[model samples]
Target: MSLEVPRPIDPSLHPLVTGNYRLATPAIEALYELVTRCLRYRIPGALIYGPPRIGKTRAIEYVRLLLARQHPRMSSYHAQCEHKPRHAEGPFFANLLEAVGDHAPHAGTSAAKRSRLLLRIREAAARSGSGTVLLFCDESQRYNENEYEWLRDVHDALDRQQIKLFTFLVGQQELLAQKTALQVAGKTQIVARLMVEELAFYGIRNAEDVATCLNGYDQTAYPEGSHWSFTRFYIPQAFDAGYRLVADSGTLWQAFEAAHHKASLPGSLEIPMIRIVKDVSDKSPF
Candidate 1:
């Protein structure tokens, strides 16, 4: 008997198919723990460094979303660092101010702008009903020594006002190398303060993590109570069209293993989250 290939489903109708699904993988759990530690212990800053395409930015966004749902009172700001030689702090703080809904004109010298930005951040945090503020900076490897020093100054200033400001620097491995260079060059204060906690993303490894990731799609349901699993869509579609790929055998688990293998890197069993998402979305007929 010939099996008919199932027609591809429209991506706009499903979260999993549209690449909008967020799986609570081990890396996400570790990120959550690091953020929780910083908030609980009143830590000033932390570092999350890893290779590119390893879901660092997505994990940060997930944490921010989770915080917004779990703790509505907490305020969070995200800024992307610019790639320029000797990047200054004005644009950085300007991004922060904009994230916090402040439209005040940033006019004055560097010192004056810094003072105004800090005051605006404090006021925004006060209005958020929680004295805790989280500032996440991506592409942090582009920051220069002067920018790091400015961050240290802001951390100190915010502390003096009794606002718990936690800054999370997310970047590649180069960030750690630059920080070490700074520490050796007698700029140990900011480096030391930010080293309170460190978290690294190594991608999803082991069978357990793969199963967890697969289960995320399998258990999730749409508005009509249909599952996100491939078996629930692909196999049924083929069967409904009077074709059967396997007769009551373990095809779902087989398909999962095959996809995992395809997603894994050469000479390594670990599969990055991005790769897994791409492989799954590409293979799903629905």
Candidate 2:
């Protein structure tokens, strides 16, 4: 049998077919509100936990961009916790220092490194002409009791220095379990500080939520002064030329429903955002 060549993608439809798009789902809106409240009230720290592959990371990224635009002078730092054999405090503080553009020392005790990190954070805040520092820690479920205590120490230090530091701990559902375990183990202070509010991210529940997601892409503007509506690109000949169309067409809704059914959990009737997008992308070629 002869090998078949793949057809080249049309230039006009490139943007819509590729790249991740941000939709203002209810979870994302809740995240925005959480951040807004934290910044407005100068809250010390908060935790955001959700299931895996449900757009938690994407929501964090969107929040980062939103904060950068809204508070240009605020300093933002992000650290991804790793599951390694080494002590968690070392890598955690090192990553924090690196995120703020400071070099972590190669030869120092953990306490020394942490002290240096505190100093660096102060310097970064001064350089940025603002005392507000936002720290986003992803994969926080890997942290143990000691790691939680370390974070509390950092938060306390920032508070004593009069710096407004807000830490957002983003992780999977186990994050709550871990916090509960800490509380049960008599680590109430850590639980009190980090568990101010746990924002849980649930997937799309109804057709209106799906419509909101599709409408986001539909309203998005392309470089050619046109919208990226699915009805315009996918219908009327999947590969043929057409004008922009509204999202009211039942075609896109049916695709979303099918994808949701396929991706929903056995007992949990929830559909992850990633699965829906993947289903849409897979069907775009038709």
TM-score of each: 0.77, 0.79
lDDT per residue for candidate 1 within 1-286, as digits (tens), equals: 2225432455356666566657767898898889988888877788889988788888888899888988788888888777875466667666556656666635566677777878878887878877888888888887878788888888888889888778999999988887779778988798766656778877776656766666665555554355334444545554455543223224444555577578774555455787767866776554
Model 2, residue 42: distance off in Å is 2.8
Evaluate model 2: give its lDDT: 0.72
Off by over 4 Å in 1: 1-11, 104-109, 221-267
The backbone clash count of each candidate, in order, is: 0, 0
RMSD of each: 5.6, 5.4
| Weakest lDDT window of 10 consecutive positions for candidate 1 | 244-253
Cα lDDT tens digits for candidate 2, 93-204: 7766676677644337777779988998899889889988888888888887788888889889988998877888899999888878877888889877776767887777
Q: List the residue pairs that clash in candidate 2.
A: none
Model 2 worst lDDT run, 10 consecutive residues = 1-10
